[model samples]
Target: MRSKFQQRRLFEQTLNKIIGCNLKALPTTCLIAADDFNDEASFKRLVADLLAYDCRYFMTYGLVAEVLHDKIDEVISDLELGSKGILTAAHSDEPIDEIAWFFVNATAPEEDCVQYFFGFDDKAAFNELSRAVKKEVQKLNAKFND
Candidate 1:
């Protein structure tokens, strides 16, 4: 078994690899999607593997409008970090079509945040949504930099 330090190093390497892949392919955001993997299990395995590292995972459901409008604080507060299963159970009555996964680097600055967007109908939709998300993020950054 690897020591905690070794495990963390490995996680960082994997995270960097994912980020690099996204940068080369998409060039806008580091948001991985289910379609990015060979199979659903592979995508899910990545999520599970990342859970062992020093990160906080959260999922947001149907909050694109809020994000676009810059009500991100409300969306963040509504997320139950590390409790996607619980949130799904609580909202079982609704049909969950998409889930946006946030892997926040607990030990690093917030700018190192990684995201995975899942459950879009196709690649076109995913690309469109990612572009919108990237635009909103840029807006937020500009607001803070001002």
Candidate 2:
């Protein structure tokens, strides 16, 4: 398993890549804190500084998951209703109070977009998230190459 420092470094690298490749998209990246941690404050600041965007703190991972999984229209409606960091439960009867996942959405003005959802509880989750980010980068690069 990678150390916390290693994980943070990898996450930063991924974010940098997204920023470099999608600068014109005016991408708004969000770091979702699913659970409390010792270094959450520092991490939150890091994400905000790197993306120059806001970090959303959700009370439960279930609510964040629901927001992530919901259709764009639903999400927009929620946002329109002034639900920025405040997420209302739309699913999950019993919300688990565990370190769930981190959510990142790299959206372009056009139809091309990428959304990453991966847990930080284990190394596998981090690796999966890394792969997903790389795939998105590749797709974006391909569009420019062509």
Candidate 3:
């Protein structure tokens, strides 16, 4: 098993790559910069609020690829679209430990959905955030699927 530090490092690097990848492909997105956030905690709170608002598709494309540590370009490429877009990403000095996000539905208007991004500094916080996100996503999936 990877140590917490290793995991955090990998998560930050991969997440930064994912952000850059998507940004290159879709430059005109409503990309909110890291400087906008006061700290990691505020960012987490914002993500949680956004997730509750409308972003429900916890995409595994970037995340799964990161965990496997392969096919990164291909995985990022798979995220490209004319309508849907990544909502937010990590900023300078703020290394993200994990990311849980909702994939935009192609059939719907972009403005109709809200996207969420989260980052963490502490390993324990990351784990807790992950669990919370999972539970929320489950609730969201049930609501949306119904």
Candidate 4:
């Protein structure tokens, strides 16, 4: 399997195009896997930051997954939603909270197994993530570029 660096480099090569795909709002696996394939560390951090939507409850109060989805996905959603310090592009006019929710609550990318492979851990990469996300928003859409 390609290392995290390999994956990140590949993604960086086309990061703008992929982010512009709006696939997170769609179901295209091509954008998901191709862009998300990162080294173990990078993948783990990205997934962790994306969050599972409900793991905070478990982490904070020791709540069991039984009452919830009882699945690990819920945990991932929580982390994604909880992390701070990620950047938001100006074009992503949506508030940071809303964006985080999107990453956390949105349906999973079918090719997201890479996240599980290293036990996605967002905290490890929140700083870098925020910067990346913030930059994306400010980038003028190609159609509107000078």
Candidate 5:
């Protein structure tokens, strides 16, 4: 009977581990430098990085984010926060091929899992997708809790 947040968190964690299967030992917090960072969003995104991407990384510059402008502040804000790598990104030096391969290979199963829970969508569709998924997970969690 996991709570909704716990279930979503677990799903996100599971996805990161599965995606990082190719790495020898996975990365850690030393990759980032809050003291060096100056933006607020970068700070939040730094924390989000840990949650989203896990500790697994081939990064050293804390993560050279190529984030959209709106997301920029959040990334700056995440400067010192932590979690899995689901919210993380790669540094400039990291091989984009490796990341591309990671994303391509990791897509099917994780997509299936998400599709099972809440269906599919691209970025423009995510607003609806997010709402549906949250509501669904909440309903299921309520049932299990009952």
Candidate 6:
């Protein structure tokens, strides 16, 4: 198991890669947060800032597996309501709450646009990384918002 600092560093590194790769220019980056953490004013501000860049998706990552799973299920249902259910059905698996970070490029012609990053399982590390990510996001908001 990696140390808390290492885990947090991993989060920072992944975020930097996302930013450096010009994913922001593509404007498809969606910083997903669980509803438990989504109520924060700062988080809302970040989302608003990202929206200005033409990013349309704001995925809600529920803190628990069951809630996240249900949310995806509901999404699948909604998608099925339109065209064939085949596309959304791919995500019908169980909700995964163990990830530290992930990225998605919604504009891709293919559905395999999501890239997942699994952080250390240490709670302390996760908490530290979350805080670090929040701070970085807040700082980045200034650049994007302006």
Show pairs that collide, candidate 1. none
Candidate 6 Cα misplacement greater than 4 A, ranges: 1-23, 64-93, 97-146
User: What's the C-alpha lDDT at position 33 in model 6?
Assistant: 35
TM-score to native of every candidate shown? 0.33, 0.32, 0.25, 0.19, 0.23, 0.33
TM-score pick, better of 3 and 5: 3
The backbone clash count of each candidate, in order, is 0, 0, 0, 25, 37, 0
Q: Looking at model 2, report the run of 10 residues with the lowest lDDT sum.
A: 3-12
Could you give candidate 2's per-residue lDDT for residues 40-142 as a string of tens digits?
A: 3443343334333322222223334444324322433534634553232222343221122222222222323322222232333345434544454443342
Mind giving the per-residue lDDT tens digits that candidate 5 earns over 90-132?
3444453443333323323222122111111122323432343
The local distance difference test score of each candidate is: 0.28, 0.31, 0.29, 0.26, 0.31, 0.32
The sequence of per-residue lDDT tens digits that candidate 3 reaches over residues 1-146 is 42221111111212223333221111121212221223444433433333333332222222222322122123233434213442323222322223322222221234322233333333342454445444443433411110
Between the candidate structures 1 and 6, which one is better when assessed by lDDT? 6
Question: Which residue ranges in model 4 land beyond 4 Å of their true spot?
Answer: 1-31, 35-38, 52-146
Worst 10 residues of 1 by lDDT: 4-13
**Candidate 2, position 78, lDDT:** 37
lDDT of 4 by residue, 2-52 (tens): 322111111121222322322222111111112123254443343343342
Off by over 4 Å in 2: 1-26, 30-36, 51-106, 111-125, 142-146
User: How does residue 133 of candidate 2 score in lDDT?
Assistant: 44
* Total residue pair clashes for candidate 5: 37
Q: What is the C-alpha RMSD of each candidate to the true structure, in Å?
A: 13.6, 11.8, 15.9, 16.7, 13.6, 11.8
Q: Give the TM-score of candidate 2.
A: 0.32
Q: Which 10-residue span in candidate 5 carries the lowest summed lDDT?
A: 112-121
Over 1-146, each residue of candidate 1 has an lDDT whose tens digit, in order, gives 42222111111123224433222111011223322223444434443433333223323223242221122222323443334321111111233222211211221224323332223224453454444443443433321110
